[model samples]
Every structure is written in C-alpha cells, then in structure tokens.
Target: MVIAFVISETFSIYSFNGIRIQAETWAEALMKKGHKVIKVNPWDKHNWEEYDIIHIVGPCEFLLQFTSSLVSKNKNIVFSPIIDTIQPKWKYKLVSYWGCSKLRLSCYNHDVRLAMKNIKQIYVRSQYEADYVHICYSVPLSKIEIVPLSYRISPCLHYPQKENFCLHVSILTSERKNVLRLIKAAIKYKFKLILAGSIDSEEKFRPIDQLIKKHNNISYLGKVSEEQLIELYSRAKVFALPSINEGVGMVALEAAVYGCNIVITEIGGPKEYYNNKAYIVNPFDIDDIGKKIELALADDNQQPSLMEYIQNEYSLDTCTKKLITSYNKIVSC
Candidate 1:
C-alpha cells in the first residue's frame, strides 16, 4: 500500500509539536512493515490518486481546500483531527471568535469540522475525540477510528540517581500548556521544578522568563537534547503536565515508566491511559496542582511498572498493526 501523509504548512517548526511526531512515527512504522509511506505538503502539487490513502495529520483551515482537492481527485482519505471538547459549545464558539479576531487564526472551530465530512475515515486518539467528531460534524460513528499515538521507549536507557525536582516537558510559553500557572504553583509550594521544551516566541517567553528568574526553584532548560531529556526523566522525582487539555499524555506515560511519579491534567483522555497510577488535577487550580505535584513527589512506590502495559497496548508495533488494518479496511471498501 502507498500512503501519503499531508503535513501542516501554517504551524511553525520553531516549537515542538506532538502531532507531527505522531505522524512521523506512524509513517516510519508503516514503512518498516513493507508499505511505502511518502510525506506530502498540503499545498504541494502531486499525483493525489496514485496513493491508496492520503492521511492528513491534523485539522486546520488549510485542510478545507486539501480535502476538496483530494475528494475531487482520489476520494480515499482519512483525517486525524485530535479534537477534544472539554469546554462547553458556547465557550468554544466564544474562544473561536476571539482566536479569529485577536490571534489571526484563519478559521478555528467551524472550518475544522466542515473539512472532515467528505473524508473516508476520521482517526482519533480516543473515544472522546471520536464521539466529539461524530456529534459535532454529523459524521457517522462508523467512519471514526480510534488509533492512538505510539509511545517510544529508548533502547539504551540507564536509570540514574534520582533527584527531588519535578520535570515537565512541552512546547513552552503556550497558554494552552498552562505553564505560567504551573510556575506559580511551583513557586508557592517551594518545590524544585525543571522545564525542558522549545520556547515559541520571545513575546510569549518574556513573562515565563521573568517568573523563572524570580523563583529559585523553577529552572527552564529551553529545549534539551534527546540524551539530556532521558537523563532528566531518569533522575526526576516526578513528571507533571498540568495542561488545559491532552489527548493521552504520552510523555507522562514515558516518565511514569521511567520511575517518575505522574501528575497530569484531568480534562482529557489521560484517565483512560494512566488508570490509578497517576495523580489527576484541575489545570485551572494552581494550589491544587501544586499539592498534587507534592503528593506525586512524595509517593514511594512511584508506579514504575507501566512499561509492560504501554508496550502491550500503546507501543509502535501494537498501534501500527491496528492502523494498517484500518487502512486496508478503508481502501478495500
């Protein structure tokens, strides 16, 4: 089978993007299984009908044009929107309006849902995203598939001596990541916090930079190397991501398996993955998030046995097989 993955054009490469990572992982896994996988930009002029499936990684306003182009040429396409609806519809609409007017987003809520209707299948990370797509876009439940992101564990990992600091990894300086609130929480609780991720812009980084300077416990590493990240995960006492939302919290899973106690957000599909091994907190509550981080730091038996469960369910081999089966089923029809 030949599959073409459509990459986003508008989003910058200056910051780390998990959705892009997921697409590349899936492409590598598929290629290893003897399928030809090709990377295609959304706006590129290429032979669309040559591939068995044209898989769009994430939804954007640019997708509306790409979806129409694919339907006119090939008609076999699937989309992984990664859409989650923790907010009420009213709030979502209000925020979408604000995004268009203030942030200059081309289109947010409506255009995204409209782009999925003509696609052959919709791939989502969880049942929550599947249901949201079905109900909001009026897409049939049969058209939505739950194919989660694969968590990769390093083959050459060595557990270092543990430290007392908590580690949080994400694209730093995003409001959606809620890192500012996390910083305040760390300062108030007097816990050592280390952050490792790309800072998107100097405008967004200014406030976070100031807070980091004022607080002795908070240190921003500003995007460490892969080796450095693994070492930090190995030595940290806890891993926390008190974000506004997450699809399945893959980094927390990696940290949990590496002997760091998990403290993650409560507003998404994390509960489905972490089960009882993680501490879930309201991302809006700084005090509560701080307390949960402290609680996670104090946990003695930090739930270091999640690796087997992840390998059995969310590993590259496990998810790639499911993805190929879905691809076959979609193309066959």
Candidate 2:
C-alpha cells in the first residue's frame, strides 16, 4: 500500500508537534509492515492520485485551505483531526456567526464540516475526542475510529537522582496550554517548577520571562531534546500539565512511563489514560492545581507503575497495528 502523510505548514514552528510526530511514526510503522509511505507538504503540489491513502494530520485553521483543496480532489483521505473540545464556547459561536477568516479562528467552522463530510475515515486519539467530533461537527459515529496515541518506550539507561521540582513540557505561548496559570499555582504553593519547550512569540514570552525572573522557584529550560526530556522526566518528583485543552497529554504519558507522579488537568484526554493512577485537577482553579501538585509531590511513592499499562495499551507497535487495521478497512472498502 502507498500512503501519503500531510500536515499543516505551521507545524514546523511548533516545538512539540505531536501530530507530526504521530504521522512520522505511523509512516515508519507502515513501512516496517511492508507499505510505502510518502510525506507531502500541505502547501506543495502533489500527484494526489498516486497514493492509496492521503492521511492528513491536525486539521487546524492553518491547514483549512489545503484540506479544502484535498476534499475537492475526491481522493481517499483519512484524517486524524486531533480535535480539542476544551476551547471556550464563545469561540465556536463567533466562528458560526462571523464565518471563515484567517484572523478570527485557527480552524474555520465550514472546513471541519466539509472535511468530515468528504473524508473516508476520521481517526481520533481517544473516545473523548471521537465524541467531541461527533457532537460538535455532527460527524457520524460510524465514521470515527478511536486510535490512541503511542509513545516510544525504551529502557531507562541511567536514571537520574530524583529531584524536588515539578516538571512541565509544552509550548508556553499557546493560550489553551495554560502555562501561566500553572506558573502562578507553582508560585503560590512555593514548589520548584521546571518548564521545558520554546516560547511561541515575543508577546507570550515577556510575561513568562518576567515570572521566571521574579520567582526563584521557577526555572525555564528553553527546549530540550527527547533524551534530555526523558532524563528530566526520570529526575522529577511530579509532572504537571494544567492545560485547558489537550488532545492526549503525551508529555504526561511519557512522564508517567518514567515514574513521575502526574498531576494533569481533568480534561478529556488525560482522564482516559490516568483515571485513578494520577492526580486530576481542574485547569481553571489555581487552588485545585496547587493542591494536586502538592499531593502528587508528597505521594510519589504511592503512584502505580504505568509502564506495563502504557506498553500494552499505547506502545508504538500496538497503536501502529491499530492504525494499519483502520487503513486496511478503508482500502478494502
């Protein structure tokens, strides 16, 4: 089978581009399974008919035009929408009222609806996302497939001595990421916080830069490689991501596999993975976030080993098989 993976143009700027990572992983896995995979740039001209499947990852507003063009081609397109339902309700309402534009919304309302109508299959990371797509976009439940995100699990080479600070990994500039709120909570609780990932823009950088300077307990480690991230995850007592919107908190899953007690927001994605295992808190409540962080830090030893669970449920091999199964179904149809 020949497969083409497509992603938004802006994905290059995203430090933690989970969608791109997933697309590449899927391509690698399919290749190992004796399938030819090609990555197509969203903006580049391509012979769309050459591939058996054109899999588009992350259908945000940036890729709206590209997706619209793909839909018109009437090719067998599979989409991993990676939809997040935690956005403010007003944003949707604004899009509905004002219509599509580059300035107003990251994803145009009509583009999502049109893509859903034309796509061969819609792949989602969790049931939470599947339900959100069905409910919000009115996409049929039969069209949606729940395929959880996978992590590359390797044996810890040298476990670092555990540290007292809490670790967070995400782009701090995204409004939905809610890094500022986490910073405030960390300061309130007087807990040492280590932030990883690059700042998105100068506007978003200024406030966080000031916060780091003012608070001795908070440290920002610009952007770290995968190896360095794993080392940090191993060393940290707690890993927290208080995001208002998250597709599947991949960092938290990685942290959990490395044995850091997780304190994630009670959003859809993380809850599916960390049901009773990790501390879940409301992102909007600073007090709740602070309390949960403190609890996670204090009860690190009590947290169960997520290694076995992740390996069985969300390992690269397991998810790859699931994705292949979905692709086969689409191709056979």
Candidate 3:
C-alpha cells in the first residue's frame, strides 16, 4: 500500500512537539511494515492519485485547507485531527463578535465541517480527544478511531543512583504549556526542578531565564539529546506536566516508562493514560500542583507499577499495529 503522510510545511519532524514526532514515527513505522510511505508537505507538488491513502497528521490551518482541496478531489483521506483543545461555544462566539481574525475561524469551522462530511476516517489519541472530535467537530462516532501515541521502549543503560529532582519537558513558548505556573509551583514548593526544551527565541524566553536566574532550585537546561533525556528521566523522582492543554503529553509517558513518579493535569491525553496511578492535579491551582509534586516526591511506591502499565499498553509495536489495522480497514472500505 502506498501512503502519503501529509503534514504542514511548518511541522518539523525533528522538533520536540508531539504531533511532529508522531508524524515521523508513523511514517517510519509504516515503512518498517513494508508499506510504501511518502512524506507530503502541504505546499509541495505531488501526484495525489499515486497514493492509496493520504494520512494527514495535525489539523492546523494549512493542513485543513489542504484536506479540503483533497476532499473536493474525492481522494481517500484519513485524518488524525489531533485536536489539542476544544474551545467552548461561547469562546468562539466571543472571538467572532470581537472580529479577532474571523477569516481564520471561518476557515476552521468550514474545514471541520468538510472533514466530518468527507474524510474516510478520523484518528485520535485518547477518549477525551475522540469525544471532542465527535461533539465539537460533529464527526460521526463510527468514523473516529482511538489510537494512542507510541513510544520506543529502550532499556536505560545508565540509571543514575540519586533520584532527587522534578523534571518538566516541553516547548516553553506555547501559552497552553503553562510553563510559568509550573515555575511558580516549583518555587513555592522549594523542590529542585529541571526544565528541558527549545525556546522559540531568547526574547520570548526572557521571563523563564530571569526566573531561572533568581531561583537556586529551578534550572533551565535548554534542550538535551535523547540519551541525556533518558538519563534525566531515570534520575528524576517526579515528572510534572501541568499543561493547560495537551494531545497526549508524550514526555510524561516517556518519564513514566523510566520509573519517574508523575504529577500531571487532568485536562486531555494524560488523564487517559495515568488515570488513578499518578497524582492528578488541577492545572489552574498552583498550590494543588505543588502538593501533588510533594506527594510524588515523598511516595516512591507507584513508579514501578506505572512504568509496567505504560510499557505493556503503549509500546511502539502495539500502536503501530493498531495504526496499520486502521489504515487497512479504511482502504478496504
């Protein structure tokens, strides 16, 4: 089967964002399964008829427009909406009333309706996302496939002896990531914190840099390599991801696999994975997040269980097989 893995030109496979990484992983995994996979950029010219299925990863504005065009051509398109957040109706209404770029909103609304009407299959990471796609986008329940993100399970070659600090990893510039709140919580709790990820710009990350300078306990390590990250995960006592929104919070899964105690928000994807095992916190409350971090640090009993569960349930092999099955079903239909 020939699959065109379509994504936005702005989406970098090497970037730390979950969607980009997932797109890369999907392409590689499909190829490994002996399927012909082609990476398609939205702006690039391609023979649309050459592929059996055009699998688009994220529902960004550009990709949405591209999908709409493909729908007009009646191509077999499989969409992974990756809807990170479902805004309330009132929020959309308010934005529309304020005339805050109605063109963008109009495009989004139109494209969502087009996808619901035309796309062959829609894939989502968690039940939360599946519900959001069904309710918010008005997509049929039958068209939605719940396929969780996959992570390669690697044995930790060098597990550090001292597991002392709390770790958070994400792109710092995203407002939805809520990095400032995490910083405040870390400072208030007096917990040693290490943050990893790339900043969009030095100017944009100034506040974070200032906070890092002011606090002795909080440090920004910029971006670490994959090996270094695994080592950090193995050495960290707690992994905190209090993001305002997330598709799956992939870093938390990676940390959990390394036996780090988790304290995550109950917003989107993390809730589906962590459930009752890790300490769940309200992202809006600093005190609650701090308390959860404290609890994670003090109690070390749950790490092994969490790690074992994630390993059993979310391995790359399992998710890849699920995805291939979905692809086959879509094409066969």
Candidate 4:
C-alpha cells in the first residue's frame, strides 16, 4: 500500500521538528511491514488518487482543502488532525470562511468545525488533546485517537550538568508563549536561566533582549542547531516552559526524556502530562511560576528516570506502531 503523509504549514517551530521525526519513523516502520510511505508538506501537489490512502497532518489548511476535494471524488483517505494551540485566532477565521463552506462546529463554533470537516479521524498527542478536540470540534469519541509524538534517543544530545540552571527552549514569540513572564520568574528567584531559539528580529524582540541583558543569570543562545538543543536538554537541571496555551508541549517531553524535572503552565497539555513527574504553576501568576521553578531546581533527587519513561511510552517506535494501527483500522472501516 502506498501512503501519502501530508503537512502544509510550519505549525509550531517545534512542531516541524516533531513531525519530521514522526514522518521518518513512520516511513521506516510501515516499510518494514511492507507498506510504501511518502511524507510531503501541503505545498507539494501530488496526485491523491495514486496512493492507497492520504494522511493529512494538522495546521495545513491547504491539506484539509485537498482532502475534502479527494473525498468528493470518492478517494479513500485517512486524516490526522494534529491540532495544537499554535493555530492562531485569525487563521481559524480564514479557514472557516474560504476553505470549507457551510461548516459549523456545534460545540467549538467556527475554526474547529472548519478543521474537522475534511478529516475522517483526528489523531492527537495526548488524551488531554483528544478531549479538547472533542469539545472543540464536537467530533465523536470514536473519531479521536491518542498517539503522542515520538522522539529519537540520540547519543549526541546531552542534558545540563546539574540542576543549577532552569532551561527553556521556545520560540521568541511573546504573547502566546509568555516568555517575558518566565524572565520575570527567573529574576525573582535569582536563578540561572538559559533560553534557546532565535528572535524573529532583534528589533522585534527588544524586550526579551533587554531582560536577558538586565539579568546576569539569563543567557540567550540564539538559534542553536538540533545537536545543541539535545545537549542542553541532556545537561539541564530542570526544564521550564510555562506557556499561556499548548497542545502537547513537546519540549517538556524531550526534557523529561533527558531526566530534567519539569516546571510548566498548569493549563492545557502540561497540566495533563506532568502530574506525577514534574512541577506545575499558573501561567499568569509570575510569583507562582517562580516558586515552582525554585523548588524543582533545588531538588537534589532529579534523575534520568523520567527519560526512561518517555523513551518507553513516547518513543518513535511506540508512536509509529500506534499510528500505523490507527491507519489500518480506519482503512478497514
């Protein structure tokens, strides 16, 4: 069977990284099972009828549109609506208006309806996401499946030396991610913090740069490669990414796999995943975030065990098997 995996937009800065890993893993896993898999982003226009099934990843309005067109032509297709918080408010509107007409979500209202119409089954990274998707799109429980994104265990990637510094790997975006709040929390605790990822522009991220300069413990490493990020994850004492909203918070999983205790916003995916393993705090309350960070950082028992758990549950092999099984089930139906 020839399978086409479709992704259009670069949804999350980290999303592309996670999807790339999953695609590579899926291709290998399915091929071993005697299936042909080809992964393509939305812009790559291919003949949908050529493949046994077309799998569409979320955040690609184009792919959603394309899937609807194929379904209209009576083509067999399977969809993985990889919903995340990265879909901004406006993009939702645009897709609702121009992409799929006469579609409205009885539960989630506008954007989710537009997102849900073209797909058959929605694949989410967590049970939390599955529930949220059900609420948002009013998708039936049977249509949603939980298949967490997988990570490759690379030897080159290293964690921080000890729990001396708080580590955050995020985009330079401020509003949704609330990076400034983290800077403030770091300042309040007077703890060392290292930030990874590039600024869209130095002028645009002036406030972040200013905060980094103001705080002696805050070090901004602009746009490190994958190798550098893995090394930082390996050595970091604790990982903190207290975002205002998140779908799965892949960084938390990556850090957890590296044995770094997590401190994350208590809303969305973080609240669901970090129950027993890490610390949680309110994203808006700077003081609360600070206190949690301080506690996690100060804990001496932080070990590599969390990494073991993540590797076993959310590893590439695990996600791939689940996804392939989901695909086969959907096709059988």
State the C-alpha lDDT per candidate. Answer: 0.79, 0.79, 0.79, 0.71
Top-TM-score candidate index: 3
Model 1 segments more than 4 A misplaced: 11-15, 41-47, 84-86, 90-117, 153-161, 201-207
User: What range of 10 consecutive residues in model 4 has the weakest lDDT sum?
Assistant: 99-108
Alpha carbon lDDT of residue 315, candidate 4? 69
Q: What lDDT, from 0 to 1, does candidate 3 have? A: 0.79
Off by over 4 Å in 2: 12-16, 41-50, 60-75, 88-107, 152-161, 201-203, 301-304
The CA lDDT at 293 in model 1 is 92
lDDT of 3 by residue, 169-265 (tens): 9888777788888999988999999999878778879888889899999998888899888888888999999989877888888888888899988
Model 2 Cα displacement at 309 (Å)? 1.6
Against the hidden reference, what TM-scores do the models get?
0.84, 0.82, 0.86, 0.80
For residue 74, what is the lDDT in candidate 4? 39
Which runs in model 3 stand beyond 4 Å of their true positions? Answer: 12-17, 41-50, 60-75, 89-105, 152-162
Candidate 2 local lDDT, 1-333, one digit each (tens): 899987776777865577778888788988998999888764677777677888888856644566567766645788887777766444653453344455644446656765565687889888878776776677788889988887665734443457788999888898888998999999999999999987769987899889999999999999998889988988898999888888788888888777788888888777788657778889999999999999888884634455456646777788889988988888788
Please list the residue runs of candidate 4 whose C-alpha ends up more than 4 Å from where it truly belongs after superposition.
Answer: 9-25, 28-34, 40-50, 62-65, 72-75, 86-118, 153-163
Candidate 4 has an lDDT of: 0.71
Native-to-model Cα distance after best TM-score fit, residue 140 in candidate 2, in Å: 1.8
Q: Candidate 4 residues 130-186, lDDT tens each?
A: 765676556789888877766555422334366478899877664767789899988
TM-score of 4: 0.80
